[model samples]
Target: MEFIALDILPFSVVDDVCFRRLVEHRYTLPSRSYFSDVSLPELHSIVETYIHELLAMGVTAISFTTDIWTSDVSPISMRSLTAQWVNEDFVLRKAVLHAQECAGSHTAAAISMAFEKMFETRKNPKNKVHAVLRDNAHNTTKALEECGVASLPCMAHTSGNR
Candidate 1:
């Protein structure tokens, strides 16, 4: 209960009157230090395990989508990648895989390295990822060529061009 509470809700919520009353003061609340040291690591471990399970599931091939953007609040540019695949149960599953800071400028070489690191989470990501869907930036196309993955332009963006 403490783990779930701390994992999902803000730290200040631990002191909420309603939350305190609901517990009836039976269980001793875990301190914030515990959450930082214990619960957070556990959460990361569980998520990594789940991702491996997904990779093990029977699927023809996986597709990916990625884009780069810089938030107004942050000086660094970041790339976001999402995975899409049909699961063993014949259900389509989609997950946002990563949002990581770009290593350097958004050149083809740099983007290719970023893509490799993101896919490394699944190990042999190049073989599993059939293609990467991205906006029609010259760098994206060049990166896909260098990485040996097919480049698919976002249909929405292509259609807009038409």
Candidate 2:
């Protein structure tokens, strides 16, 4: 299940002949339905808990990066939120807090609402946010302002910076 999630592979991959043969030699493969209906949720919960634990352990501040993009194969627009911070061990760590599909227009209000929801779901206090790195879209800038969080333009996206 972790492999499927990490590789972004379809749950049905477990049913593939080559995949089954490779793993069936030493382990039993569960049905695709089991992975999709049970293991996926369990994996998500475990990862979420681990991220929370890491953040709670002497992490003082967090920077966030957020963006929205449309899939080439589909009309789905996904908004992603990622958090970065230095841990107690002095190691820089980052986690993708959310990558959810957006239903409507990518307006400032919509972007702000999505960011707030991601923070709320992770139980992260907005006060802990140091800054948000984002694309130089007017809506993105306005959204950060609306949320009262500092915003930095993503240098990679700036013209002639890369």
Candidate 3:
């Protein structure tokens, strides 16, 4: 429920807790006292393991998008949209890579390169890239075009602004 509130609602973590408190006085927040801190190397190893497992399962091809943000200390942050080809029918599955550094055009180019690497790792060199759906960012569009990937403007954005 905490994750759901964080992902789908505009409320902050504290706001979510407060909301739950308002609904039920007897309920208590989950305890964070028993968690183990994972080392950076361990985290990387786990991610690599998952990637290899995905590749072994015949996942290939991908599409990407990026969002840029500024932190309180003026550092740039990025959120990434990544997708993989699933099954023989070509339905795409996606995951988010959050709070990465915003590198502008380079970030967009990196996403394309990541897809290329995923294709190579899956041994599917003939993978078809259908489209990159993103907000109308010039650098991102340029990068996608340069990578020989077609792009489509985000329809949700166009609709929201209409």
Query: Of the candidates shown, which would achieve the greatest TM-score relative to the real structure?
Result: 2
TM-scores of all candidate predictions against the true structure = 0.81, 0.91, 0.51
lDDT-superior candidate, 2 or 3: 2
Better of 1 and 3 by TM-score: 1
| Worst-scoring 10-residue span by lDDT in model 2 | 20-29
The 10-residue segment with the lowest total lDDT in model 1: 1-10
Tens-digit per-residue lDDT, 1-162, candidate 3: 334323654424424656666666676644222111233345555665765565446555555454445579865656454545565456555554333555554465765665455445544343445566777666667766766767788888678877
Off by over 4 Å in 3: 1-38, 70-73, 88-92, 97-99, 104-128
List ranges where model 2 is wrong by over 4 Å: 25-28
Instruction: Look at candidate 1 and give me any clashing residue pairs.
Output: none
Q: Note each model's CA RMSD in angstroms.
A: 2.8, 2.1, 7.2
Q: Whole-model Cα lDDT per candidate?
A: 0.79, 0.89, 0.54
Q: Give the TM-score (vs. native) of candidate 3.
A: 0.51
lDDT tens digits, residue span 1-162, model 1: 344654677765557788778875779877766766887678777876787688677866999888988779988987898888989888888877787777578889988877777777656457777888999889988988888888799999899987
lDDT of 2 by residue, 1-162 (tens): 878988999988988999887884778788989998999899989999999999999888999999888889999988889999999889999999988888898899988887788888898888889999999989999988998888899988896455
Ranking by TM-score: 2, 1, 3
Model with the higher lDDT, candidate 1 or 2: 2
